[model samples]
Target chain A: MDEIIRINHITKEFRVPDRHEGLRGSIRDLFSRSYHTVHAVDDISISIAQGEIVGYLGPNGAGKSTTIKMMAGVLEPTSGEILVNGCVPYKNRTRNAQNIGVVFGQRSQLWWALPLVESFRLLKDIYQITDAQYDEMLALYRSLVDIEPLLHKPVRQMSLGQRTLSDILAAFLHDPKIVFLDEPTIGLDVSMKAKIRTLIHELNRRKNTTVILTTHDMGDVDALCRRIVIIDKGKMLYDNDIEHLKKFFGAYRTLKLRVKGDLSEQAKRIAAELPECSVSANENWISVLVNEDKQKVISVLSQLQKSYDIRDMQLEEISSEDVIKRIYEGGVV
Target chain B: MKRKGFRFYLRIYFKILAQDLKSKMSYRADFIISTVGMIFTNIAGFVSFWIMFRNFPSISGYSYHEMLFLYGFSLLSVTPTQCMLDNNWNLRQQVYSGDFIKYCFRPINLFFYYESEIFDAKGLGQLAFGIGTLVYAWAKLGLAVTPLAVLKLLVFLAGASFVMAALQTAAAASCFWIENSFYVLDLAFRFRDYAKYPITIFSPVFRFIFTYIIPIAFIAYYPGMMVLRPSEVSLLSWLSPLIGAVFFYLAYRFWMYGASKFNSTGS
Candidate 1:
């Protein structure tokens, strides 16, 4: 794939005033000055290719937003370089902005009291879209996002989901080559989230728009992105295919078994025999942790059946949350 | 594309301004009351001057009507920049809220974006009243309608607006380091209050300061002085607007420097 964004050893640091907490401390803080330097985005390097939907995964204060801000031309890196579409974003903001679209989920860019249509008209003027192009793009967005019902509604009157959808549409109205979405489905309901995800997939497939999405939801990653980049403490910890991420960190599955009678002795024996598995028994239910290579759950059940009647058996795939927790706790990847 | 640039920015500006007005109009009573209140406040300011002038025959060799011409012109000249560009006045909030991020990615100039957000109907109303007051003062004073005087006034007004706008922009840009710019803006306002009256009333040192350093005299006193007393139209009078323009350019440079600092600091 052709490279669409090339971020080379980008670093961003901030100097925040060091202030004491109390009233007395505050008065002293006015006269006595101190500052603490925070490295919001360290010397990090990553590149995204054309038609790529990269999932940028991180917890809060993990520099995901800062990185995005730099790429979006909202922030300048303290040192190092970032070139989006062969243009340094902060240095050539107008040209960079023409080729890029950015959406911040927490803020609505639409005019608050104006109808969605009016905002679109203003955007067309701001972006200098031709009349025909504006019409075609608006029609396309209306159909894709089903924004017909929302066209006449004032932005402040629209629901969060509606507003978010409109914001996404507004971002794409310029037909930008790259779109940066920060928490695009942050506060949406399950159905709205699915709709947004589907819309994003469709947009990518049809337009081949390069997308960089920063989201907290793992489902957003699983459903949309084939690649994932994870960062923590202003450093990139993982940057590769999603499957590789899962393979490296997303190991271990759970086996939950329900038996008919009290089988504490049998459970203990099984726990002792299967040293690789973690066995937990509560009341009539027993849960066993199994490695990825061990899939003969039937054999374990058969052995358990010799001592106690098996009432119900179920197997569950290890969730991504558990994988992340294990990664954090074990420092595995 | 070059020809279209100004029209493009102006179109977007008016569209945004219209939206702001509509939003304000949603509170119909508040809009009306505020507009009326602004007119009353301006009238009160002029009334206080009238009362003061009644006791004193003249101030610094200028009569009441002549001073009103200066005051009215200064108020009118700065109104558009103040009312339209006042959004830049909230640089403190913009910094704290990280709202400047929005401007960085826009395909327009940051100055235009900063000015557009605060375009309110109340401001438009004030601007209209200011212009009206200027015309009334001109007619009452029987100021000359010579082409040269009109040309000078227009240049002076444009230059004054640019300087005022740039100063506010510089103050707002201070948010990069200070995080709160309102105090700086407040101080700038106090400094600007000296321009409300004639610079002739001040000492030679102060006159020099207003003319060369802060340069508020270019907005009203200098141009008005040149027009009302054509005998004083030296080369300096014609060059005063250039000083304002230079100050405006410097202020713009200061704003760009602050923005770079902000970008480096990140959100």
Candidate 2:
């Protein structure tokens, strides 16, 4: 893989003015203003290679946007260095913008009143895209995304899912070398999520477009990302392949057991017997966290079966929320 | 992406402007009502002057018709700023709503794209009224109407309008820091209407501040002086083109500086 992006010790500090409340405070601020530094992106460094689809994951306000802004040339880092395709993004904005595309799920770049394809044509002009290239990209986008009915509809009238698909099309129509998708599938249904995931994968595979995706949706990470960078509190927690991460914190399973009667006694018994397992009782279900020790699950279930008539037993994979907590707790590196 | 020429970006701006006009047309009744309302607003300014003239011929040395020329000339001078650049008047709303993010992400120039976002055909009424007033005032003044003088007036109005537009843009850019600067803009415009009258009518202190400190006078007063009182127009009036160009650059630079520090309050 060819290195296309190199960020070294980049930190973005915002001097947020700490203004007091009320008219008196505002007057005071005029005379003696005060500000506090918010380290939105603490000193963090990561190099990305061409054609690599990396998931940039973090909780809200964990600095995902700050980093994206820096990379996209929308912002400048307070300290440190960043180079995209051999040029500093903020220093050479137009040059860097030429090779990079960005899709912001919260804000639409599509003209609100224009038909979706008109926005695409407007972008075609902006990018100086040739007719052949435009047709080629349109064909590829059409095959991947089912936005045919939406192409003629105004952006303001389109559903979130349709708009998202259209936004994705506009972002990639220029055939940018790199694409940054910020929460690309947010506020979409399961089917929409799957469609977008397929589109993302197809874009990367067909065009070899490097992608940096920032999303709270784990299904996106699971569906498309081979590697992911996890950030917490303005610092990198883990930067590695998904396989390694899953193996390090080996895929834990959850057993959701519903009992015939009052199940707290048996749940307590299982807790006592399998001390390593995490056990919790909520409503009618007793969710038992079982990992590594296969026999522990069997021993616990047999004990539960003995105590009460086994009404139902469901085994599930560890959830995204739990995985994020584990990363925050430094359980994986 | 391929490297596009200047024409390419102009086409993009045209497309964006077309989209804006179409969007404005979406609410047909609102468009018509707003157009009528704008005409009435423009007419009201003249009406206030007309009512005042009914009581007294003029406030200072000038007469009622001369004041009309002054006021109409000022309106023509501000057409590009207040009318075409109307979006700058409400840019804080866009900043607060995070629509500024569109320009940030696009490959086109931010300033141009931002301006294009609001083509503002709603200004048509004002523009028509302004041109009509200027023609009426010019004919009423009954000057020699030399082509050279006409050319000079056009040039002055053009340069002054550019300055006005630049000032409006600078005000909008301040929102990057102040977050909500419509109040600040309102305050600026409260003093702005005074330019519609002769600056000489005010105290010397106000005259100096509006001329040198804020330079609001240059937008209409000084330029209008070129036609109204050419002898009083000093050698500095020659620098109108230079001042307009430089000031426009500085104002746009100020906008870019603010945008650089912009921590997008994305909702």
Candidate 3:
């Protein structure tokens, strides 16, 4: 649980020229230049520990990529400090890069025209990996990600899923202590997504590699991360364990009731009698939001059954997507 | 580490260069056509000068062969810098596409990333043409072939390449602020135009500026003067290359500063 990364009050701003539309405005812009500052990453701080897979969740343009770039030393913070493995990422980039790996899902770090193995070899030279160590890591990556068919194929010819898998493998081949994966499984099929998730989990468990992942896929969060940090509008809204997030903001659970003899009125009365529930009727099924604890699920179902002949019933727990939607809509936690 | 260890990096660098060459060779016909086209384009400039010299016989106090020496050496000094550092010419695209990120994470000096991609097939063609022109000028001018003159010429050529590479790198590094300043590269080559002739034809102050401020004269004129053993070629001729070396160092420092700015701006 030792801290591997410490980001303290990091902020980034960009000065963008103000340009107007049309020919006249373009001419004026050329002569009299003006600019406005964009606050891409606001003052924010978060620390991640060793072997922890934390979900950095945010919508597009919410500064997720900016933060990852800063952490990876691809960009410097406008203000404040970032320390990875006890070194400033920007000032000591080469030293910091030696122990860290990064992958941007939108871009391939692998050489586009070369075979995947060739790109890996180039990386080995760039990172100065020993021959034995390179072979060992290549073997491990091949076993974990099914990269055998991919090693010989040119990167330009590989499918998106194949390329993504290769990219993930390349990022970890150097045995970096900490890896930043930005949308690692983006644009992948269901099976590919599952395979990547398993590979990530295996890497973390086997190597104790700290991972910081920024993804729009909620399934990625549910499947891999035990902790989550959500940011929006360049501000951190929540940072805690997944269970706490579900408990704090996961307010409503759905109950689906199917009753006999069109007993719609009786179901409504039953729902009304239970003040904690909100009722909605559709066809022969009545749906209710049970606001009480899940312990009350049985009681609520029994009450509905006693009043009306129950044909079938179903219950669903609140999902992470629902929790995120509520948070985005400014729901109280 | 020992000085020999630096050679290891250079060896690896050439491997990468070989890989790039292989990739470029994939387009075989285009490569051949471009190589031929480059020779024709360079010859066109010399052809214009030959026609001018044929009519007038001399420009100011210099003859045709003497001017060819200046032209040939200037082009020769520039080819090594331009061809080896071709990546600098595309710095605008690198900045716009964020490919600079690749260099930021590497354990090597970022300057090498900008320097290594400079050599390509077109540059090799230019180098061939420059050398051919130099040999032609040497034979026609009846230039003195003393061992000392040859030694000084080699030293001057090396210093000239260093200075030219540094200037090109500085021009490329300016893209960090201006973003898409490929025009700066164009401006640099325009100044190279000044090196195609002897600086002795200009006023003293103009000569000093080209030699000291821009150091274009170091790349061609001073070296040409040293080889020709002109009376004006004093001890100052030997020291002029130091100007090129110092400018190279300053340009390198500026490139690092610009890289730092890129890291902060992230544009």
DockQ of every model listed?
0.45, 0.52, 0.29
Global Cα RMSD, each model = 4.9, 2.9, 5.9
Candidate 1 residue pairs in backbone clash: none
Models sorted by DockQ, best on top: 2, 1, 3
Q: Please provide, for model 1 over B103-176, each residue's C-alpha lDDT reduced to its tens digit, 9 standing for 90 to 100.
A: 67777787667667777556666577667777787788787788977887787777777666666667667777
Each candidate's lDDT (Cα)?
Answer: 0.79, 0.81, 0.80
Which candidate number would show the highest DockQ if scored against the true structure? 2
Docking class of 1: acceptable
Q: Which residue pairs clash within candidate 3?
A: B83-B118, B83-B119, B84-B118, B84-B119, B85-B118, B86-B118
> Tens digits of per-residue lDDT for model 1 on A38-142?
988888999999999999987788899899888877677889999999989887787788888888886887777888998998888888788998988877776
Q: On residues B143-171, what C-alpha lDDT tens digit does candidate 3 reach at each position? A: 77889778887888888887787778788
Off by over 4 Å in 3: A11-39, A247-325, A328-333, B1-5, B202-215, B234-236
Residue A192 accuracy (lDDT) in model 2: 89
RMSD of 3: 5.9
Question: Which has the higher lDDT value, candidate number 1 or candidate number 2?
Answer: 2
TM-score per model over all chains: 0.85, 0.92, 0.83
Interface RMSD of each: 2.3, 2.8, 3.2
| Model 3 C-alpha lDDT per residue in residues A1-333, reported as the tens digit of each score | 799999999888888789989999999998999999888888889999999999999877788878887877767888989999988877777777788888787678777777788788777877888899998887778677667789888888999988888888888888998988989888899999999999989988888999999898878988999999888767777788988876664556778888776657756776678777777788767878776654377788777667678888888766555566668787544
Q: What is the Cα-based lDDT of residue B132 in candidate 2?
A: 85
Q: After superposition, how far is residue A35 of candidate 1 from its true place, in Å?
A: 5.3
